[model samples]
Target: MIALSLIPLYLVAVTLPLILAAIFGGPPRPFHQELASGLGILAFAIVLAEFVLSGRFKSVANRIGMDVTMRFHQLMARTALLFALVHPFLYQGSPSGGQRPWDPSRQLTLTTDLSALATGIAAYLLLPSLVLLSIYRTQLDYKYETWRLMHGISALLIALFLLHHTIYAGRYGAETPLTWLWVAMTAIAVGSLIYVYLIVPMKDKRQRWQVSAINRLSPRQWEVIVSPRGHSGLNYKAGQFVWLNIGHSPYSLHENPFSISSAPSSGPNVSFVIKELGDFTRSLHQVQPGTRAYLDGPYGSLTIEDRCEPGIVLVAGGVGIAPLLGIVREIRLTGDPRKVRLIYGNRTEEQILYADELADEDVTHVLTEPPQDWQGETGLIDAILLDLILPPVQVQDWLFVLCGPSAMMDTVEDYLIARGTPSGRILSERFEYD
Candidate 1:
């Protein structure tokens, strides 16, 4: 059934280039190289629009296949560029068996044809931009938003240029199936973009959250509690996160994902404990109560409900403790008496964000520092602590949840594995961006 459904898509992917080749009189075997190229370009534009319009990039990145979707996007962009490169080479070649004295350099020198030159230049400019932006997204963090907007605009420009290039070069200005196909694809792409940019914002405004209170948890950490003003409660499981836009400046695409620190039982008021880590977070204190905020999810699979084990082990470091705290609070609220142990790690005693509250919970604290008078576990969390604390039970019967800096989680996972913990029972949540 799935294969049958994918047949039309497969046909579109494969034959679009052939149609282009035939239309352009570029390749004899394939109907038209230009028509095929047009279809390829149009199909890619549609896919790009679908991704952006559905707002699934981040969700796909974090959930369906972590880091894999990013690679796929990069691959598709490169493939589009390759198709663009092939169009000129294939079209200029002789349709007959004999070799023709056609030179690519000669074709480049002809500038009297403005449409062709524009199409070539647009293709040259846009393809490389797509590749470079996808590859260097993180490194060019400051220019990310500008590059993203430019990238979208450039994609549209490339599509328009390709359409013109096809129409003029192939002599299929009208009354061509390929022309209609191109038109339909462009309309779909444009409509999707409009909906994503316009209608989505209006819907988001109606779903906006109002800040109830912002409590200073520590010197730099704060717990921002918010609830939808004219809406019912947000149904989210423990450990899932939400992307928050505190000031709702549409131009300020500075939404950051934060774990819900408070349990869902806390009702309409969802709490996010944030530390002043970046420019956006540092400015959070200035945000007024009742300020409009946009929320984008309930993502991630780190909840305790997902685990069906006799006992649980939660390892957290710094603010990584936020989600773990939610899980703990949830367990307490439900009165689920499953044995849960926590090995909370921190750089120093002072930096431990939720020290008093964690101490009050029925959980163990493994601090990285012990004062002169202090007599709790100290130094990096290692196998020694695991051997000392972890109870004797079948490894599969216990679920280990690790949330912290990647390095800390890696170390803890390795130690747990060495101590006979089954690989399936160990789950780690990464809070960092790729």
Candidate 2:
């Protein structure tokens, strides 16, 4: 209910500038001119709001789920980019000249001054570049950290460019009330960045942590454990994740999101099962014990704690088992009476993690490539396999939690829905939306 309510609120916020412009705007110009200004105003409003929706605000992201928040953010960026790109083109037929003194509203004469249009032109070029770079970030060869830093700086630059363009070049934007609103919105946007990059880090610096252990779980996966320095540690639920920064300053952008593999019931220490995929994970062996660390989360909503479902179904693929492991441990440690089942899939036996720990549970191990003399289920966790493993009653009633490869998750979610499972009965999160 809370998440759904945010949609209407967001609609009102983005459309507020347009509404104000219609009321306070001096005189009606050509329909195209008014539309051009409206688009520009709406685009700037969205750009400002993007800073807060950058998947850093706990108040917002926690309620809607980080993946949903980020997906919305990405969608809005593309929408704003479309509106901004088309803004200047709509003024082509308008009278091109400096704002006339007689026409204080500037409804007739469009600003021809290069200084006023330059920022808009710059933002026009840079906004598409920013959006394109983000869309193709993984395809490019740049480091993730470098790309992230560039993204932030470029967004701020675009926001500033749009702000200047709107104030000086726009007719409705020069109005006192709208101008003040734009200034306040821009300030809030910039302040959000400062809070994320500076204020949050400063606070985290006090609640420090240290690396305690790093062990190889499989050929290409590792288990990293960190212990709190002085605090009682994170008050996170099972199946939550954290932005972990090991051996780096709290303010550094070297942090990466990883799911917690250690249960809250276990101790004040946390563990993550990370696959050697990215630059940071591949270099984990170089990290030493007792290295300074920082955690910026406990984010994500993939937990199964406060549910009244008769049974819980945990589906994980590859390193996606991290949070599920935390959940399993919690259920065991707390002796939860609700029945639980884990459907863990991997490509090979060597890729499996914590087989011994999961041996006691009702786990269905599916592998694409099974070794000789294998006894567990084989092949991918497809619709057929899911139907065979999960009874119809369980499918309709049990709480289904899934995390893994996008294809596998889509498959499971679609199949469950086809089997009459309510959407609310399923829980899932995607790290990659692109």
* Top model number, lDDT: 2
Q: Can you give the TM-score per candidate against the true fold? A: 0.69, 0.98
Model 1, 1-434: lDDT tens digits are: 33245447645643564455356532233435444445445444434433332323343434433223444455555666666655555544434222125632122222236655577567666767766775676677554446557766776776677666655544333336656765666666666566545654566667778888998887878989898878886788887777677876633455777888888876788888888877778888798898888776676667778467888888888888888888888888888888887888876666677677777665656676667776667777777776777666734478988888878877888877876778667767776532
The Cα error of candidate 2 at residue 345, in Å, is: 0.9
- Per-residue lDDT, model 1, residue 106, is 28
lDDT of 2: 0.90
Most accurate candidate by TM-score: 2
- Candidate 1 ranges beyond 4 A from true positions: 1-117, 120-124, 127-195, 249-254, 360-395, 409-429
